[model samples]
Target: MSGSTHTVTNQPPPLVGYDVFAADRVLTEGLERHLDPGPLAETRAELTVLGRAAGSAQAREWGRLANVQPPGLRTHDPSGHRIDEVDFHPAWHRLVGKAVSAGLTAAWARPAGHLRRAAAFLVWSQVEAGHLCPVSMTHAAVPALRADPGLAALWEPRLTSTVYDFGLRPASQKAGVLLGTAMTEKQGGSDVHALTTRAEALAEDGTYTLTGHKWFCSAPMSDGFLVLAQADAGPTCFLVPRVHEDGRRNPFAIQRLKDTLGNRSNASGEVEFDGTWARRVGDEGRGVRTLAGTVAAARLDCVLGSAALMRQAVAQAVHHCTYREAFGARLVDQPLMRTVLADLAVESEAATVLALRLAAACDGAADGDERERAFLRLAVPAAKYWVTKRCTPLVAEALECLGGNGYVEESVLPRLLREAPLNSLWAGPGNVQALDVLRAVQREPGAFDAFLLEVGKARGADHRLDAAVRGLLGELGDLDAVEARARRLVERIALVLQGSLLVRYAPAEVADAFCAARLGGDGGAAFGTLPHTLGLAGIVERARPVE
Candidate 1:
């Protein structure tokens, strides 16, 4: 409403049709109500950045392309999976354009870590989970690019001003570039070491010849790909152009499109690269580390996006509960229903904040050292592990609140339920994250210990939350003797509180406005629980004599 709306006349051939703006508006309004002015401003700023980068002509084109299908209704009936092909829209490319520009700019320009955190929150909060989760991984590249200012010049202009409407254009000066990496064969998935993709280096042309059959190429039909291959040295990232700037097809061919569950808005296909031309991303031998780092940031994005969809579901549930009747009373008036709603709100708040905290830590740090990387390495998996794990059950709970109405396509709950599955498994699985946490504790005892000490100090000030901290510590044992287990417990609790900090900052009027609710009641007690809880405890545990 702040800006004047412009009328656009589309001149493109038609595909599927839809009520495009309805769901978007529903989400927008709900978010406005739940979020505070600060986050709201942040979200608006992000929207502005996204809007500006994707020119109006491209925006309308995407809207028309996206409007062609009923994304909310598409599914594979036989296996109860949503057919993935139904999800690809030219409009999504435009969204990516905006995301890359805005996200990268925020990373580069924002001096305060809080602004970067807010940008990350806004980007993922707007996401409705699907196959897009993988495509969503593209945004992860922003933070790394920001960390290395030298890469900023290379990434900024292309990310902020260019739109890849047709896919990857190797020669285009656009800001958003889709890097494909779907090279998993039948036997190789999470185990990339078992991959069969080969990229033979040709020093004469400064290009490599790539040959491979890849499964799960998320954007199989588009622009460029970050092809992963095995060399004599090790696994590595190769930039392969799929389309030329003149719009000629690159050597990468689409073999078959994979039918998928949810996120039908993006493509997940089988691809073949026959002597595909490519350039190295980092070092030849450092590909696996680069790949893992890329994947780690992506895991954080999964958590953030899932949390957003969860919020959308919560909004729908809350709206329905307040208006719909059950036995002559509003569903929200039912005590049990209210309890379920309350718990969902609490969890959503927590997940969102932890995500922002991680973003802040990663973006704020000037040095891209092991310590900075450690925050995201640990936080991303934990987030992906927890948020998605919570989403399915949360959707189910919301569905129960809706009764039979929830199962209907006319209602968004069914779409949400169908879409929720992808996040839990994406980025990395839950067990992978748990192991990452174990590794992080073992790798950086000093920083990890420092982080824990902060949490402990915060907890010491709050008797209620301290009890929870103590319970975890007691279960894990003293930090000095049982450092690894103790670190895990402290870290998880700190993460929970970190998320609450965002909720506290955002407009939770019920908690923020009322003195009794904020100061004298449970909200008051909860508000005082997290600042340095882990920090203090970490110090105490470390200071104790080593047994």
Candidate 2:
């Protein structure tokens, strides 16, 4: 006992036993405002239970185990027969099962589904983000399958089921199913039109055989995949099942699982499709159109996931600062540290408000609202670009708040940092999302107008927001260098939209700080650079997670 010169002391106790959902004032209030009172009550109760589970020691262990023990690919049987399968850690399956049981994948089939699912996804992702790969793919596949009523009729029920069936088995044998996608070839990342994978008609009944390679196939062990292949007519979408109708494995060969920077718990693979049987999802030449809704849905999930990362990162930082003191006071109460935490809180809250607003738009769109549908056309890409872009920096700064401890694997901050860049890269990259924003503005003028209409609601509420909107409108009018300035233009669009949302619903202090620092440039270039005189204490307190 006397061997060491000093004993360990002054460290804060581990952060556990807190309700993630309740601690998140922004999410809870947003859910209350967006959902009907009755549904809000019930959904809040459900999320509270989930939040407790997510923050529990057991769940934390699951997250640690999942990442430490990544998925492994099993390419063949011992007897030399090809049996392509990706095996996951038991913890991954536990997380996925919890997510499925929470109705994260059945958003389209439930009441107030999008709002519920969005909140659930945000909460669950904070626990383990890798398992969300299949969860999001399964959720997004609904719209793509709906392009063909017969296919939708056959698979929709299974996709929406709450059961988690894990294995490479026939769809008929499972109570539910998960989905994945293989859209890009090696030559084309976001440019799906450049895909060279070809599909040949196998029968007059619209079945086909695909022969090509997919450069990136996420969740390789998924029950089915929505793939893109060049057909006689043009590039088309197809549903490729893992097991054929005759109960035999499809001719799908997994080349190897990718070694990704993050998301280690999920398996992403390069696959070769040799005579892989598939059925056309929509019209032969309407692949892009058929997948439009699916992509938009997945993009929304990206926003939600990023927001979750930011929230958790900030929460961890605040929690650490609250208990760890330095010099003469708690770190959280230190003036400069308070300013930084408050600034991060502002960013996190703004992201949460915008994400939930998008979820509300999804709900409204599903209810046959034309304006909501149009708003989504512009909002999805903008939110995806901005929210995901903010995550990396936010997490990095938050990790710094914990000093060296945050950089180590023992803390979740490192994982959050690794996961941050992924969302921006997923769905599409920054340039892709920016270009998509421009495309929507030019091709779907009505959608852009709908977006402006949504933002216009809070015009007179805040002068800073009003000025930002006016500037954005002026920028939109000039299309000469639009493509060259797409990212800048998209950033303004996203900021203005987020500013508008904050002004309308956020508490006065939070909204004012966001508009000043984000819109009016009242802050420095880095995090924690908010004005000294601002209500930094109040904002930081709001973001702090308590037991």
Candidate 3:
């Protein structure tokens, strides 16, 4: 028999071998409440399959291995010729292949595509997030490419393909392809229009040769990139490919790979394009306008990514507490522990509800619903700002729930904690998002009206929500100092939206707990600070993952 000291006791079983999709009451319920998206049976079935893979022990191991052995940069071939490449572990390829084959990138032309794709992305990201950088770039590239008919005609089918074409090849030869985006340079981070990379027009047919340095290029291994560069007319967008049609290397030189804190499995490179052949994406001086759709889609992905991390962290915490024992009782049964879990659960549900609502709006907007498009103008950035900002703290609290065990590298919480801030930092940091919302509120009155109309549907549902709406309106009535208070206003806007969503869609207990704790001023600053009067155990139980 194993010795008592060596035996493992008082440990929670691994949270694996479960249907991540089916177990998520909030996600499933919100899915239905939002759009009744494309035949529920079919959509649910497909997501369930992906969910099973995400929750499997095998998939979890893939996540671990991929992170442990991050991708490597190859700047030159053995001889002397420059052949910049990024080499990823087998697990990375598998994860990317799984996501791509499941139609994660084919969301543009299908029924209820955005909602379904967003749901799938939310689930798979819990497994491994780094590889999704390329996946997201490829998916978002569809709209930017569509700005040019010839470019769209050539690249659209390849981008939306379910096949995971994993190597550099001519676009015409590949069954599928991946893409990247490079808007930020060393001198200009979010100031994309201040680019110095020059693009010289070669012929009238959208061809150009770009020459300058690109400070941050996402997914360097991608076959092509939608980059920003200065043209004769001003700043403009260009499509730069890794391999030309005649099988000649483009003059794109990889300066170095970025040493990021997390998301190490994906390669972020600083590249130099010297007389590099590219095709103009849109007319000069319109790079930002051409990239509008791409940026919006990316911001929405950040929301989903943040929400997915929160759900996984909460699931892990609840699963741990459900089995842990202290003071002669199950940890989850303890009053204080239950309160914390419930609080975390409430926050997670709010994020998921808001994210799903946004995805449904994407579907609507795709179907030519002008109202949904306008709503996205304001909601996407506000949600991105608040939800992503909340992820780091929520993950940290979830880790604390596991006590000393959580601090160790063996636990997934450490990895999750490292991954937490990435969404907030990426796709324009919190300030950028808040300021973008402020600009929208100033220039796009229709967007604000649409947002008000959406929130108005839940006007009489909850007193807290109603009061919140009133407070927001009063605050927005004056813009004399709005620039200085943009973040505060945006946070309130996101909270009210979440509150409205819960009031109309979530379970009574969840909505009540959320309104009471978040909007009703009954909670503290940290997780687990919800009022003790609520049904704590029931709320935690609803969020627990099955094994």
Best by TM-score: 2
Residue 210's lDDT in candidate 3: 87
Per-residue lDDT over 122-224 for candidate 2, one digit per residue giving the tens place of the 0 to 100 score: 8989897988999999999999999999999889988999999888778878889999999988998888889899999985687999999999998899999
For model 1, what is the alpha-carbon lDDT of residue 117? 38
Distance (Å) between predicted and true CA of 439, model 1?
0.9
**lDDT for each residue of candidate 3 in 1-547, tens digit (9 for 90 to 100):** 8556676789988889998898888888766766555567788899899999999999999899988999888888899789998899999999999999988899996898999899999899999888899999999988889999999999999999999988887889999999998778888888876688888889667889988898889998999999999887888888999999998988888888999898877889999988999999988878888889999999999999999999999999999999999989999998998998999999999999999999999999998999999999999999999999999999999999999988987779999999999999888999999999998898999999999999999989899889988999999999888999999999999999999988888888999999998888888888888888877778899999873
Rate residue 49 of model 2 by lDDT.
98
**Sequence-dependent TM-score of model 1:** 0.71
lDDT of each: 0.53, 0.92, 0.90
> Which of the two, 1 or 2, has more TM-score?
2
Top model by lDDT, which number?
2
Worst 10 residues of 1 by lDDT: 538-547
Instruction: For each candidate, give its TM-score against the true structure.
Output: 0.71, 0.98, 0.98
lDDT of 1: 0.53
| Candidate 1 vs 3: which has more TM-score | 3
The ten-residue window of minimal lDDT in model 3 covers: 30-39
lDDT of 1 by residue, 1-547 (tens): 4975886432112211221112233224434544568866766565544433322344434533543342332334478742322345546655554444445323434444333534444433333334344345444444333433544466545533334433334545454554445646777876778878887988854367888878777666434556678766777666666655576556766656666666655667777778877766666766766666557666766676677666656655665666666677766666556645555554555555555556656654544545555555555565677677777877777777667877875455776787777776665566666666656656756555545554454443434444544555565455454544543553454443443343344334321222122222334233222222112222112111111
